[model samples]
Target: MAFGADELRVLRRALATVLHPMPLPDEDVQDCLRLAGAVDEAVGEAGRMRAFLLADLARYRGALPGSAAGYLELLQDALVGGYDPVPDDLAALRALRHRPVAAALLERCRTATERSVRSRLAGRAVPAPAPRGRLLALPGGRAADGEPERPKTPAAPPGPAVPPERPAPKPSEVFPPRRRPVPPVGRRVAG
Candidate 1:
């Protein structure tokens, strides 16, 4: 996740040009894409892919209820192009709470969402945010003090050595004492 000063400088310049209070002018969009490419390189394929998909899903989910102008058509096109709402997209739907369609879609997608994510979006407390933690942030090594934690692979804690498993007993040892087969079911023999 390390990026050089030069790399960050490039992104900063590109982002400065691309992101504006108003919508991006068409000409600067390529610069935005270039910044995104740099970010993808930093974060990696899966991270970038999920973020990209989630962003698109959020946009479409926001646009879904729109009947004004071309909004519906835009939403339809986005969906047709393989954008399905992801668990993160549920927050946007939640904002549209009064709308029945949003409610229904939330209900439908609730089952598909990872239980921890669903619980979070539903405002329910879950024990310790599952094993992976948040999708993008808080990856691991969060401190009990709630600081932003550095991610580290947990090492196995040192402990008493596992004593070697005893080898299996021989079959005769495993069976009842071999010399003591004196009695049948119907009658007892005097020992």
Candidate 2:
């Protein structure tokens, strides 16, 4: 069965309260009720399921040869019914698939495992990455790389129109750059 997040949270909170040493307040009696009801239902359902599984295991064992009868009966009694069937049970069943009765149950168990896996995968949402080259730019002419564009400064007054293109100037000479002045020891600067 499936449970919502809120339901699971409530169940966990109820279990914590019930398991604590302190006595619960009268106001929290509703939580006690929920815990008791959930526990009782689970135990009752498990008992019924255990009976069914033991019966099914016995029926399967009866069809096997005398050599396997003892082992099958031992495994049937060892089963707790809530947990998964062990590797040995599956392996034994695989060897017995030539028989019609064992083949159906083995196929059903495999199908159930596959369906559960597929359902779990389908329930999750795998978010895709944002499409390439389509990101929205932030304000103030900043690129996605966080570098801001340098202002145009009107193209250096049109330079010399036909000076034959001299070699590039040094990086410091290319712009009027200045050292970032630090603040005074205590008082702040006004905006």
Candidate 3:
């Protein structure tokens, strides 16, 4: 969880770069800051990986490029990268009455989310273990279908419970419990 001084410095720089421009206004900037904070806290330093994507959002806003379509595309890419800053950025933009920017960013966020999901599925595609291979000839390598054989290892039995050893009490600790209050016998006099 600890970031080296250099890494922390870099994070600070990145945050500054992402936040410096007053594209929207004071209130919107505050909101964006809040959103960015939550996202940074939630994702930690690794979240910096997607920081560039958020910066791109700023650039997209400035140009008002491709009519809202361009903005949307960028937002989508940012969201697809799994960075929470996109939605927050969109909300802030909307609150500022930048409808076109908001709408475009939202669409992009949605599209990016969808594309990211699809890409993940694609990555998991893992071509069905090619039809044939020399592995089939090895023992336990293939079944009757000539498919590559897979060896199954039996699950191991539960290990013994290890009881932590307690250190013996020191001499002073043992004597404290044995001491009992003794009344001053002879002084119990009367009056």
Question: lDDT per model, in order?
Answer: 0.45, 0.46, 0.45
Residues 1-191 of candidate 3: C-alpha lDDT, one tens digit per residue: 34556556544544564566323333433444454454446344333434554676677666653434555555555444444444455554565335665666656555654665675688743111121111111121123345543454443354433334634233233212222335666756688
Candidate 2: the clashing residue pairs are none
**Over 4 Å off in model 3, which ranges?**
1-51, 65-67, 86-88, 91-191
Each model's backbone clash number: 0, 0, 3
Task: Flag the better candidate by TM-score, 2 or 3.
Answer: 2
Cα-based lDDT at residue 168, candidate 1:
26
lDDT tens digits, residues 1-191, model 2? 33457557656665675465343343344444464456556545545655665555655655565435443433434331222444545677688777665565567556654655675699942221112221121222222235544343332233223234444233223221323545668977799
Question: lDDT by residue for model 1 over 14-89, one digit each (tens)?
Answer: 5554353333333344444465566545335434544554565456555655631232233333332334445445
Residue pairs of candidate 1 with colliding backbone atoms: none
Q: Estimate each model's TM-score.
A: 0.23, 0.28, 0.23
Number of clashes found in candidate 1: 0
Tell me the deviation in Å of residue 111 in model 1: 3.9
Model 3 RMSD to the real structure? 31.5
lDDT for 188 in candidate 1 is 69
For model 1, the stretches where C-alpha displacement exceeds 4 angstroms are: 1-43, 66-105, 112-114, 117-191
